[model samples]
Target: MNKSAHWIIYVAMLLAVLTVTVIVSLSVGEISIPFKDIFDIMADKESMEYGILAYIRIPRTLLGFAIGGSLSLAGAILQGIYRNPLVEPYTLGISGGASLGVTFAIVTGLHLLNIMFLPLAGFVGSFTTIFLVYTLSLRKGVLSVNRMLLTGVMISFIASSMMMFLMSITAVENIHGIVFWTMGSLNESNTTMIVSMIAIALISLVISYLFATPLNALRLGENKARHLGINSNITIRILFIITSLLTGVCIAVAGIIGFVGLVIPHITRLWVGSDYRILLITSFLSGSVFLIFCDIVARTIISPNELPIGVITGLIGGIAFIILLSGSRKNSRII
Candidate 1:
């Protein structure tokens, strides 16, 4: 089949999957509301299941989808800009910075003032780390990918160390909260948080989509991109800001969920080819579906005792990444 026809069919399938997944997620929560009752409750707010449907399941599902899409798109952008398939928010230390922020909030007792404060702190930490990494990686007016990677790794290590120190000094009772935030969860979802995440995810995705041509040029190589009249340096800088915003918001809302950013982009690339315009949209949809499915497994695998969403994504994404790496190596040897 032609690529365009294949894309149309693929997108239709994804939409179907997304619909089913949303319905199933809403229906299979703690109370086990029937699918019919779920629709009924949505139609009539006075229904008994209204609170659960509106206040709990809907927000949680939406937040999960938004966070997943944002992370995946951000990862796609980073991979394109850096010309490295393995680069992602988590690997590049953005998640570590956000984790440190959450840990700091827990240690400082800022979480007591308001639930929103944690994400705020996370954003601050993430942006700070982005700036630091970018500044450190610049050399003679050029952003060195190798230097950026090394700096990110070093910063991640430092952030992890700081987090461990905070954990050790924090009260035993507070340690669980810190650990949970780092692990990631969506149980605390609310309307305000969901709205904020949706806004950020949509805005960032739109902005990133507008730069798809430049990103495609960038993938060809910096000099080639500049020859095409694209300012490689400026493009990279703008990409960094957009990715930082998306990563920061995702971490703030959902904690340091790993692997979605790393795994989803590669998977989407395999399905849709490397065109950023198509890749971005497919990645967002695939990512949303992937995370929602993982979340379903996470919550239902142990019944009433829910596992952290990050744990599920990490386990699955880690395994998938290893397999992809092995396959890539085999292909290289064959070539």
Candidate 2:
């Protein structure tokens, strides 16, 4: 089939899956409301079912979708900019930085002052680490992709060690909460937070889409892009900042949900080719579907008890990463 036709079909399929997942997620909670009753509850806002759906399920689902999309889009952008298929927010240490910040807040008792303080600390940590990586990776005023990758990896290791130390020293009662936060969750999601996240995701996705042509040019190498009238340095800097902000906000809201940013972009690329315009949109939708599916599994796998969303993603992503690595090695040998 032609690429355009394939793109349409893929998007349609993703939308269908996302719709089904949302409905199933809403209906299959501990209470087990019927699917038909879900709609009826939506129709009648005064009902208790309406309250449940509106206050909890709907907001949580929307937030999950938005955060998932943001992470995937950020991953796609980073991979394109760096020309590295293996790069992701976690690889670049952004999520780790956020995790560290949240851990600090929890250990220091800043969470008691205001619920917003935790995410605020997360954002601060993310941006700070991003800047550090950027500064450290610069060589003669030019950003070196290899340097950046190495710096990010080293910084992530440092952050993880620091996080572990803090966890060890923390009160036993707070350790579970810290561990869960690192693993990620959507239990705290509400309408206001969901709306804000959606807004941020939409804006960032649009901006990233607009940079499609430049990003495509960048794939050919920096000098070539500059010869084609694209400011490679400035573009890279701007995109780096944008992706960092998107990723930081996502981690701040949902904690360090692993693998969505890494896996979803690679998955989308298989279907859509490398055109950022189409790739970005597909990644966003596919990511939304992927994470919502994962979240459903997290919620339902243990019945009344729930697993952290990160644990589910980690198990799945780790296996997928191994498969992809093996496949890539085989392809390289064949070539």
Candidate 1, residues 85-154, lDDT tens digits: the string is 8899877888888889888998999989997798899988898899889899989988888899999999
- TM-score of the candidate numbered 2? 0.94
Give the 10-residue window scoring lowest on summed lDDT in candidate 2. Answer: 326-335
The candidate 1 region of ten consecutive residues with least summed lDDT is: 326-335
TM-score for all predictions?
A: 0.95, 0.94
